[model samples]
Target: MNPPLFDLTYCPIVPALEVIGGKWKPLVVYHIYLGAQRFGSLLRCIPTISKTMLTQQLRELERDGLLHREVFAEVPSRVEYTLTQTGLSLLPVLKAIGAWGRQLKEQQAVPELVA
Candidate 1:
């Protein structure tokens, strides 16, 4: 018998990681958690990201059905990005991760390390 073309039975988390697995994906999603924001705002919030890198991450997230981008044909070409329903579903996950990180920090040998 032939083996399955793709082996996803190992774990379900594999698929979630495929979408928001990138280093910046989760951060980008977290930024959008507040509300719709402009491209400039996203860049400002994530100062470490370059224009090119941010654009690439945004496109990837959009392609993954986690974000929605709207472009306006104004003088400056306004663009806004907002999280989709699928993306909103990650709120609880993000919150949980944040709590876990805090716990790890508090329990670490050097609690101040988290600061």
Candidate 2:
């Protein structure tokens, strides 16, 4: 019998998914690409996500180098999140996928007319 193809060390995609392949991760990435945003802004943009889930997802993205977190020390601390170079590199791919989805939706909307 052949051994399994994916040992823990063999594939990075498996681990990458752990960081950014959830229902909310892609949305977060897409929004952050538009501009740097604070946590409150992210919560507003992704209204369906619970605060706990959003915080967990952001921390995961930051740990994976897909996002950068900046903290400003002041009377009350300020923080912002922005995409890292690696994350920004994914923008074109996301845009292309979104365009394709829109085209597919348009195609599905018109009923076929019999001649």
Candidate with the greatest TM-score versus the true structure: 1
lDDT of 2 by residue, 21-84 (tens): 8798889998898899899999999999999999999998898899999999976899999999
lDDT at residue 93 of model 2 (Cα atoms)? 65
Q: Global lDDT of each model? A: 0.88, 0.88
TM-score of 1: 0.83
Per residue, candidate 1 scores C-alpha lDDT tens digits across 15-112 of 88888887798899999888888989999999999999998999999999999999999998899999999999988998998899898988785645
Off by over 4 Å in 1: 1-9, 109-115
Name the runs in model 2 displaced over 4 angstroms.
1-19, 112-115
lDDT of 1 at 69: 95
* lDDT computed for candidate 2: 0.88
TM-score between candidate 2 and the true structure: 0.78
Residue 23 in model 1: shift from native, Å? 2.3
Candidate 2, which ten residues in sequence have the lowest lDDT sum?
Answer: 1-10
Clashing pairs for model 2 are none
